[model samples]
Target chain A: MSEVTRPTLSDALTERMLELIRTGGHRPGDRLPSTRELSQRFAVTTPTLREALRRLEATGAIEMRHGSGIYVGADIERLVLPNPNMREIHAAQLLELLGARIVIEPPLAALAAEHAGGEELSALQRVLDEAGRHLRGEDAELHDANMTFHRATARMAGNSVLNEVVDSLLTVHGPEQREILQIFDDRRRDYEEHLAILEAIEARDAAQAESRMRAHLVDVKTVIEHRLQSPR
Target chain B: MSEVTRPTLSDALTERMLELIRTGGHRPGDRLPSTRELSQRFAVTTPTLREALRRLEATGAIEMRHGSGIYVGADIERLVLPNPNMREIHAAQLLELLGARIVIEPPLAALAAEHAGGEELSALQRVLDEAGRHLRGEDAELHDANMTFHRATARMAGNSVLNEVVDSLLTVHGPEQREILQIFDDRRRDYEEHLAILEAIEARDAAQAESRMRAHLVDVKTVIEHRLQSPR
Candidate 1:
């Protein structure tokens, strides 16, 4: 048998500290207990506790403010992948990405309807109103508006990890939508779908919100499929 | 407005090369064109091409072997997060993670039943038999076997990105599983459900595979919920 190497004391403490942050009823920007207190609680020396805190800081799971105290940073659970370059995306890849979004987003919309607070609901309303104005205008930035609407809906779902994954998926969806920009000629239909989804959200109708979102994606998918089938 | 700095020549070349890797007919382990040939094709100097190659290597999208030509590595699409430290997982977090799996895995099972080959199906059957032996012997390595079963199902789905994500999910599932190991008292029932799901896959019944997988997860979720509600 190969030799076993035990984990260093600091490494174990770092994991314990991270666990506390995750389940310790602490939010972002919440202060951690002082070094002296932490050391006593863990029954370790002050230097060892400081070593653990230093490691946590490196993982983006905690922040040490000079003279104030240690506070939680955005943390590992919040790290998102870099935005993918759209010019590099292939049609098949984009379609696969959209298929993934189709699977994930409707459920997210349902969760949003079940979870959104007044603040999140108003944020959704603001995005919808802005998107509507853009759709009505002659020089509309419809792509950005559409992305904003979906991203906002993701945020309303209240699961940080899911919200981040949806954002990454949209990095592909945003560009693909742009590639098929001309197919969204039915501006009124697009606007009404957005409004319907928003109304379902506002009414706290989870099932309706889910179905509306799914229907919207299916429409977009059909346009994309048509574009892929026909040559430019 | 911030000052606009144009991307360096190497950065542009890197993006172009990555684009080639994505859209090019190159699969993992396929040899890339010679550096001299590629530089000539792109009209870029050799140093710029080398810099770009370096970047791709760093991103894990390609590999370089001494005395041999450059080859496509595993690519960005296959990178999965490391297994999490389960000692840090909380009951609520485990429940939420299980819920995410419930939402995602049934569809994956359906996809798998559509895509699995004779070899893949046989591999799955082998895993089930091994797990059953462990259960019958009362020396069960249930956790590893359970993960192997789900991960194999994910692989059979034939979606690289989804498979990678499922692997990462199993990282959490693997360890949280150990924490709740006691609740799995009905090992025979667990084995039977897996067999049922595998039978659906072997029969190529996508809908039945999906429903069976969903029912299995719901059972696991119920167990987790019961555990969370009552203390030992």
Candidate 2:
């Protein structure tokens, strides 16, 4: 899908504005040109200019003050995902989330196996040990340990963007995982799965690590599916 | 990691606020209690209550009017991912995006095979047809056709959240895809791959569909990686 194309006036203007920021000539608080001046410069209408500015503002690239003018807001490179309501999530959404994990984590685990060094391996071990201590308790510490283990493995994968995506998705599942942990007796199995993933990564067995991680997430999806089917 | 535990004061208070919003007693524009009133009701300090309120606001649960009050802004059910800078994306980031796609699209294709009906299948066919027409054009129209084909596949997967996530990620790569298409002559290969995926979906061969999708994305990743290694 690699092909460059023509842009609409608003899109062109938005690109021009972003290009101006990217040159590092404009600081975060620097004001952009007024709508009138910008429209004249870009040969567009004020409404078109405003539309472009509004698009930038929505992206956190720039901001408009009620009485003042538009100014550069943030660097605009940092990506952020919206939060899903944990309390309001339905069974279908839960499956979708798990399905996403099932697809992502196995690849990430393989990457971890290929890329993980001693430090990352030790970090995974630390989290696994912590998880072991909390295995028998239906407590927040265990939940935290579980979250940390997955996140630590993502860290081991050494891909910042992948880590961010996984982190955000795990945050969505946080409360639900807690709820499930309290109601179901699955911590031992989960811990075993975590250990197996760690072992594969430590052994630098990318395929095994990938398959184990996929299997672990499948177990999670199964438990969640059963719970959703017979909501207790 | 199925473990539920006690909530912090702020966590408990946030749940209370979300509960009020969820009960349908408070509509989207309804005002939440003032800081003092809410803190008093929850028997917590105003700071503690405000912390909870800020958390809620971050999730799009409510909006705080500077001098007025907090009001329900939107339901906290939506998920939005920020668009990446396609024009300025480094090769590494492009590969990361492709890697993400490799994980996602295969499973999505499998699901589409299992779930897509006649209408969705026809939609996929239509996009594929459009893509075929654009195969020789190094223009934005071709980019749109390529994007629409993949998005149609996601739609056929019949998962709203998955569809949204894939759409946003593809949007991130849209311009870059255009640039690559303009620079490369691989459109025929891409079209053939798309046809294979479509054929698998049409035949209700989930495994075949998934493998085809994954292989196609892996090819994309390899091309981008080689290009990054030897920039043309």
Q: RMSD of each candidate?
A: 8.7, 10.6
Tens-place lDDT digits, model 2, residues A1-232? 1111112544577788788777857767888776666778788755455545655654457766665676887536544354534465666777777777787788899999999999878878998898898877647999999889888888778776667677777776677767767655667888898999999999999999999999999988887788778877
Residue by residue across A1-232, what tens digits does model 1's lDDT show?
A: 1111112565588777877876887877888887667778889865456545644553346676655677887644543332232345667766676666777788889988999899988887888788777876643387678788899898888765566567656653555566655565677787789889989998999999999999988887777788679856
**Predicted structure 1, TM vs. truth:** 0.68
Among all candidates shown, the one with the greatest lDDT = 2
Clashes of each: 0, 12
- CAPRI tier of model 2: incorrect
Question: In terms of docking quality, how is candidate 1 classified?
Answer: incorrect
- Reference-based lDDT, each prediction: 0.70, 0.74
Error of 2 at B110 (Å): 2.7
